[model samples]
Target: MLVVDDNSNPFEMSCAIEIFGLARPELGRELYDFRLCAAEPETRMRDGFFTLTGVAGPEAAESADTLIVPNRPDTHVPRSQRVLDVIRRAHARGARLVGFCSGAFTLAEAGLLDGRRAACHWMWADAFRARFPRVRLEADVLFVDDGDILTASGSASALDLGLHLVRRDHGAEIANHVSRRLVFAAHRDGGQRQFVERPVPAVPDESLGPLLAWAQERLGEPLTVSGLAARAAVSPATLHRRFRNQLGTTPLAWLTGERVALACRLIERGEERLDVVAARSGLGTAANLRARLRRETGLSPSAYRKRFGAGPAQPTAAGGSGP
Candidate 1:
């Protein structure tokens, strides 16, 4: 992987560095070989707060299997033609090109995003639309995965897309390992709309907050929307509207997702008993668990465990902060 930078945001760059740069021998082998490069050497980053030196030149991107363009300094102002030239050349070689945050503009400039759907920070939506009318700009989504050419929104969401890449390359278990190591929650297939709706930072604490907390605490107990509504002293209809307005999802679907997530967590933790996993996750019988697992993740319980479960004597130290 080649990381292209032009005064890139440190946080966005760190997302790639953490998963690809860091060493994890317990996983058996290196997951990714990463290098840092830019069109100019000793360039400033994060609005000149830091300077990157000793990075390779644009040639590094040509032979790289995956190339990343971190957030650029300005979208309206033109970046060096030399940088755009290298990006266009790399994409022609079928390299997986990713644009993080405003880096979507860099990809757009390179013509990689010309006809493909893309995503970027919502703040830059109008500028991107006005500048590149050809590209299908999805502002509401956290990220857009258009096969090899991927685009992510904002600095923080870059992590989501990076983890998603890991899941796509390896499997859910490995991706979940990376998430556990980073101390971040693993997000599912839905777009970033759910996140945008609740802006109180990680799950809101409004009217249904208490009820949501209660349901999470009792995930093993067969739950219903009406039961949750009664717990909150609201009619079922009112609760339904509240869920739709706040979480952008129906009550039962959200519950099933949570149950599936719990089951996955249990399976990933090396749970041996499938029946226990099903019962504990409130999916009832093993058949139900299998059906739900297959429906949500497209893998049966044992298959998911085999693909993503922890290996023997696996070191727990992999779960921590990245460099």
Candidate 2:
């Protein structure tokens, strides 16, 4: 695994370390050999008045099966040619290229993202589009898994992308096992919209935050638009209008999206019993979960599991973050 580190936030870098460096040998898996490659061979990072040293050089990516570009510090600025060259070499040699968060900028700079759909932090969506006009930028999503080229929004989305790569390499079962260990969801459909900032819709003085939090806590219980509205002490009409205005969706649609998100986590964690996955995700039935997964991701639960649920010994396409 090749991890290309830039002047990236250590928080994002830690996400990579957590996903790639940690090994699970109990299941007889050949875990990623993670390498931290620095463009200049050695660099210094400020970690709260402490200096962190970079030991690995760009050549660390030479033999990698998968290359991961972590988020860079600046989204609007162009990257160095040295960084571009490293990326080009990896791509030409058929290494899978992944950009997490602003790392998409580095990929775009290398011209690898030309004519391809890439995901970036939605906060920098406009700048990313303006800078890389040749690249098809999908601003409203968590990530994009387009075959060998994968890009993800920063923050928690990096974990989502890493788990996706795990699933792609090993299969869902292994990825789910990792998720269970990490207390995270294994497969979050990369298409969920990035939390973009928008003008708050004009609605009643009522707050949706509390209601949404309450709903999250009761995901296992039956939740309906009417039920939620009752809990929020609002009329059904007011609630629907408020949801549409504030969230850009009806209450029912929003609820379903939330449930599906939960279901995806449960499914990724090897909650193989469809009934259990459904109940946990609040979908209520195996059929419902199957239908929802299919509609959202074009894959049945079993098919998804089959493709991405294998144990973690499978060979990667190339260039992830370890030795």
Model number with the top TM-score? 1
Q: Tell me the lDDT of model 1 at 167.
A: 68
For each candidate in turn, the TM-score is 0.74, 0.68
Model 1: residues with Cα > 4 Å off, grouped in runs:
25-29, 188-190, 194-221, 230-250, 259-323
lDDT of 1 by residue, 1-323 (tens): 54556667888877878876777776786566677777777778878888888888777666776788757757777877888887787678767788888989989988888888999988899999999999999998778888788888877788888887776555566777788888875654436452445445333434676787789889999899888888877788977877776766678888887787788878888887988998888888889999999876678877888877776432221112111
Report, for every candidate in turn, its global Cα lDDT versus the true structure.
0.75, 0.73
Q: Tens digits of per-residue lDDT for model 2 on 206-239? A: 7687898799888989898889989989899988
| Cα lDDT over the full model 1 | 0.75
Clashing pairs in 1: none
